[model samples]
Target: NQFKAMMDSANKYNVKVIVDVLPNHTAIDHTAVLPALDEAVGGHDKLYHANGFTPIKDYNDRYQCTTGEMGGLPDVNTENPDFQHYYMTYVNDLLSLGVRGFRYDTAKHIGLPSDPLDSLAARNNFWDVATGREEVKGLRLAVPADSLFIYGEVLQDKNVKESEYAEYMDLTASAYGHALRTVLDKADFNADSLLNWHHPVDGKHLVTWVESHDTYANEHESAGLTDEQIRMGWVFLTARQNGTPLFFSRPAGSTRENYWGNNRVGARGNDEFKHPEVVAVNKFRRSMSGQPETIATADNGAVIVVSRGNAGAAIINLSSEPRNINGVDTTLPDGDYTDAVYGSSFKVNSGKLSGQLDPLTSYLLYR
Candidate 1:
């Protein structure tokens, strides 16, 4: 029933749909494979990569190294032919289903080269190659080419280098860029002189975000900021330009658990389309913003806004209070622009414009 409902729900919308391919390991009880325990590991060859070690207490060994989180879940060895055969078949199933792309969860831990491939290597990296072109080519009988938009979940990098994950996928987002939460925590919320990390998106791939389904749902979640701060953050995350946008779904909160929904804004009290905070954010984002665009930064420090063809803009304030967006001395043509605080409204003027946004709120301008 659930699968049928999902398939039905998918057909109801014309937008492309995707599935998350978690590579690090299978869930503790996932039926994808059987216990490498008593069986000969048949019927699910790609699910296990024999490391040539018996007793095999766990699947993380030479062929498959675990991500250190111990449990019943066994990891797959991307380098193992047996595992490749298993996984490629799985990938083919989805492509045949007309699914648009894939979002790889924890792609870093599964590949054979755990040594951290360089930028050049990451770009040239290909799952199709590792699985063998012949295997991929043969799949033409089942899956079509140019059928997937693959990306990954790379949580953190202590070094803070952009180029590392930049070369690897078509679209990527970060849980690290929490402008929404940051602004909510601020007292003044000045976006001026704030260095917003939004520009590198349109021309290159970017997966930018604040929270996700996995984000904290307990009352203690949005630390350091106020409700208002988180609200503004949602304004930016949804409506910002470049890269694909992700909706955060936390089941246990005010209707809008994440940016994709309205737990933050409370549907502007009326719960209709125009009043709530996020509705304003959502409409603007949908109208504008596509991949392969770049951001415009006033300098490295004061203010930075990510934009894609004036479709959407995320203006952030890096300070404790409201910051003024100065370098943006230019005014946009008059039209209905979406405000993070206020819902959609026509831009009253075209002169150098400045508005006082809370610390955590990002003002989106959509024409």
Candidate 2:
């Protein structure tokens, strides 16, 4: 009932919900795979890999990576036709309940048809069937393939077929996130340093983030980032015209001093998503969709400017002190503009923008 209510509320707001679907493995004792349940379901031998609970010793070995246990959880035999049908049916059930898309967790652990390291038993057309590119015998989805938003967590690694995965759905741009984080840590706004996406596919087929749940909660790699730093990175990412940018909300009540305040599992996180700068940049992104993006630096590379064609620009000041934008090159048409978030005034004249930005702040200016 709670899930239904959430879906209903999301629909009322015209928001699309993408639920996380673990295609790699389930709990070691997941009810469906238990002895009694497996027997009742006619003992579908291919439901899980024969490797059982054996831990994968070498992740680079494609067979063990795809079939053996990950973190002690039993890996699913994705190559099995019966498992494919059952998983597709499970996805269909979610779609029937108003889920518009899915985030396939540990997608790289699932074998690709082109992976040479896996034996014939480990290869499958699971991606094709899941995305409705190839039809399953009796499986149907409540939502069509064209209407659903799908992305896979195909973390980049040796033998990971990213381009093949892109043929099925968007893949997370983990390298790009790392680059942004590096830039944030160094307070360097070098346009050349941050421009490369480091992906095999185009940006449209990539999901980018300033930080992810794994970066923060699991490894604590991004836990050191303050809310301000994250907001700055987000402004630069969201203002771009390419990849879909995702914002990770920290634990509820979390602060610089208290990293895990109110860290109840499954509870809603902090409200930084509604921050004025974030809201402004999101609006700018939506309003300027399809516009070409240009990156530039001002204030001795302390201020980074991301301009979307002639529509608008996101100017981010990454330094500790205020900076003056004096005749910075821009694509915005000549006109007077005001920051959407803070109402700061800016002017574009003769193909250049000039404005005063506060320390560690961002301005969204649009015509």
Candidate 3:
């Protein structure tokens, strides 16, 4: 009832909800694996892979990665016909409840149809069934597959099948996030170094992020990043014309001094999502859609400017000291403009943009 009410509210506001679906494994105590519910999907024996609880010894081994247990959770036999039907029915249930999209968790661990490491009986058609490419009789999505926003957490690995995953849905651009973090740490905003997504598939088929939950919680890879650093990264990525940018909200009451405030797991994060600069950049992204992007760096790589054709420009200064942006090149037309976020003034003359940025500040200038 609570979830339904939330979905109803989201629908009233025209917001689409993307639920996370775990396709790789299930909790050890999941009710679906119990004897009573297990029978519906060909009993417990057929529901899980034959590997039992064997932890994966080598992730590079595609067979083990797909079939073996991960983090002590039992791997589902996604290739099983009965389980496939049951899973599809589960997905249809979510769709019926107003889940317009799904983010497949541990998607890379799921085997692709072309994976030669697994035998024919072990090869799964889960992607095809979920995406409506291959339909199951009496099991259909409540909404059209094209209308759903599907993406997968296919973290980059030596054996990752990124192109194959892109064929089905958008894949997360993990490498690009790492690259952006490196540039931020070095305080070097080189356009050439920062612009490359480094993904095998086209940028449109990738989901970009500055920092993800995994980066913050699991490995603490991005846990040390200050909110300001994240904001700068968000502005740069969101201003681009390619992949969908995801903004990760940090934990509530958390700060650089206190990493985990309130220590509340699964609770809503801090209010960084509604920061004025973030809101402006999000609006700028939507307004500048379809416009070509041009990137330039100045002030010894302290400041980076992203121009969206003649529509708008995003100026981000990463340095702690105030920097003077002098004669930076941009695609914005020659005109005087005021910052949409900070009210700072800037001028574009003969394709050259000049502006003054306060310490660690950003400017969103639009026509």
Candidates in descending TM-score order: 3, 2, 1
What lDDT score belongs to each candidate, Candidate 1 first?
0.47, 0.83, 0.84
Q: Model 1 over residues 1-367: C-alpha lDDT tens digits?
A: 5544565678788656778876546556546455652132234543433421122343333222222332455554344444444566766666556666778776544443334332212322235543234463243224443445656665443332334444455444453355444534443234322234433434236665555544544453553333444454555556445446564533322443342333454233223224355666677676664532334533233344555453445555544455545434323544445564555232424533344545544566654
Better of 1 and 3 by lDDT: 3
What is the per-residue lDDT of model 2 for residues 337-366, given as tens digits with 9 covering 90 to 100?
Answer: 988899999999998999998988999988
Clashing pairs in 2: none
Q: With candidate 1 superimposed using the best TM-score fit, by how many Å does residue 322's alpha carbon deviate from the native?
A: 9.9
Q: Is candidate 2 or candidate 3 better by TM-score?
A: 3
Clash tally for model 1: 35
Q: Which stretches of candidate 1 lie over 4 Å from their true place?
A: 1-5, 29-72, 112-126, 129-137, 140-147, 158-168, 175-180, 187-203, 213-227, 254-275, 290-330, 334-350, 354-367
Best by lDDT: 3
What is the descending lDDT order? 3, 2, 1
Q: How far is each candidate from the true structure, as Cα RMSD in Å?
A: 7.8, 2.2, 1.9
> Higher-lDDT candidate among 2 and 3?
3
Residue 108, candidate 3: Cα error in Å is 0.5
